[model samples]
Target: MRIIIERSNLLRSLGHIQRVVERRNTIPILSNVLLKTEEGAGLRLKATDLDLEITETAPAEIEMAGATTVPAHLLYDIVRKLPDGAEVKLGLNEGGTQMTVSAGRSNFRLQCLPEADFPDITTGTFSHSFTMKAQALARLVERTQFAISTEETRYYLNGIYFHALEVDGASRLRAVATDGHRLARAEADAPAGVEGMPGIIVPRKAVGELQKLLGEAGEDGDVAVELSDSKIRFTLGTVVMTSKLIDGTFPDYQRVIPQNNDKALTLDRSTFSAAVDRVSTISSERGRAVKLAISDSQLVLTVNSPESGTATEELAVGYDSDAIEIGFNAKYLLDITGQLSGEDTVFMLADPGSPTLIKDGGDEGTLYVLMPMRV
Candidate 1:
């Protein structure tokens, strides 16, 4: 292959495609990025690690149309270090096996693999295809991705669950994720004609890649999404990302949310979050439990540890019910607090050791459940 591409465009595509390349590969070809030049005006760069793949095309001046593979990370670093606006020229040696890259005063040679060695991805069989605003997709990931399970044994909880639902006679799209300790559920009005799409479990790696791509596409741009029973794809302008779905059934999370919690406390979000963090210093590492003491208009957060001492902080809240004492993990409390984009947060409590429900003071479509800890 002999092609010339702008330095900035080449570097950007490298940054996106190289992320899917594994650092250590049993097969040498898997460590390389495949570069193919078409008969027309652009070059396509692809990288994969069996589980995920990223393909992006950049406009280039092609003298000869061909394909070759080069070490992904090394090539990316070389091009990135070059001066901006410089033109990058790539060519195959006389034997057509060794590849050379040149830009500015720097030059490098790398071993190449044939195009037939790269794994082919079949994107023609998607059962569902839809489009939505990039900002909406980014918001869905930001609102619920933190609750994804890190435990390897419970494979079903390892990713966000995307499904279609109906709310108030209107279609809605929802993203749900949970660890054993907490659950986060967020929903938005589904785009028109996206009502009957089947549910899919998007693995954690794919979620991360989509997040990065969406960030680059900006908030106003729209993204096209395609999915099959076994794979998912996201297309943003000239970039495309595809990955295999996690083959596991997610547990029904609705049963765990408490429906009858009568006691409610509304507090300034920053004040409550600060109190929880300040008092939890005395909590033991195992439980990290902080006790909540609520009265007429005051709330107290206390943490007691046998090894350490005790710490307490008080806050003024909107509560007018009987005194209620409850315990919760400090980490869980912080997770819920960090998800808040509003000034005030509401907490509904049932008892000392039951599940507590939390939501933004003004929104009902997003709800969280945190299991309490014993004090």
Candidate 2:
């Protein structure tokens, strides 16, 4: 393909899609980004890692309408180093084996893979389509992505689950993630056309990339979502991403969420988080338990290690329940606290052996569940 695209535009498009290209690939063509010149759509750039694909369009002057593939990262680096505002000229050799990149005094000759050799993951028909405000979607992802499980054994828990549910007679879209020890759930008003959409598990990788894109979109942007039982697509501005959904059933998360836990302990979020951090330092392992001793109106945080000395901190809390002592992973406690956006948090406790429910006072729709550990 021969096209003249502004350096900034080319770099932006490459940055959006090249991330999907894996550093090591068993297939030769999988390492390349496909560049195709169009008559009215400017220039099209695409990259894929078999499971996920990202495509973006950049404004360009098309000299010849054709297509070719080249190393994704190498081309991105070359374009990134070029002077700002320089026009990048891409030309395919007559033999169709090489392409030349020229901008002012800089030049790069890269081997080309025939576009015909690149495999396209066939996207089947979509069963559901909807749109969500970028900010709203960002909230759901940010609140729960940290809790997504990394254990490969429970493949379903390795991604965020998106489903539609009716709450108080109003449709709502919810995102849930769990790693057995902890769970996070966040919901927002369901967008148009999402009423009967089938639940889908978005793999961890796609969730991360989508999260970045949504973050960039800020508050005014909107993301168009189209999905089927097995595949999903997201369209944001000039970029389009398609991915295969994880084909596993997520557990009924409602079963683990405590229903009758009435013990409420309210404390300043920053204060509690800081205390947890300071006390947990006494333990060498992040998974070590940090004991929480709660009574009438006070909370004591303590950490004990066989090799290291014990550390403890106390803070006044708003609790009127019976005295209770609970142990939780230091890392897990910090994670849930970090996600809380409010000044104060309320933890609903049942017993030392059951899951504790944590709710963000600032965000009523977001909640977390943490399984207690024996100290």
Clashes of each: 0, 0
lDDT of 2 at 249: 93
Task: Pick the lDDT winner.
Answer: 2
lDDT accuracy of residue 248 in candidate 2: 93
State the lDDT of candidate 1 residue by residue for 1-375, as single tens digits.
789999999999999999998899999999999999866749999998877889999999998888988899999999989998999999999776899999878888888888789886645598888899998888888888889998999988889999999899978999999998999988887986576788788888888889899988886898898888889888999998988888988888889989999988999998899889888877778869899999999999999989999999888999998899889889989888988877889889888878999987655788899988777
* Deviation from native of the Cα of residue 94 in model 1, angstroms: 3.1
Model 1 misplaced stretches (Cα beyond 4 Å) = 281-286, 305-308
Q: Could you give candidate 2's per-residue lDDT for residues 241-296 as a string of tens digits?
A: 99999999999999999999989999999999999999998898745799999998
Candidate 1: Cα lDDT at 350? 88
- Each prediction's RMSD over C-alphas, in Å, is 1.6, 1.1
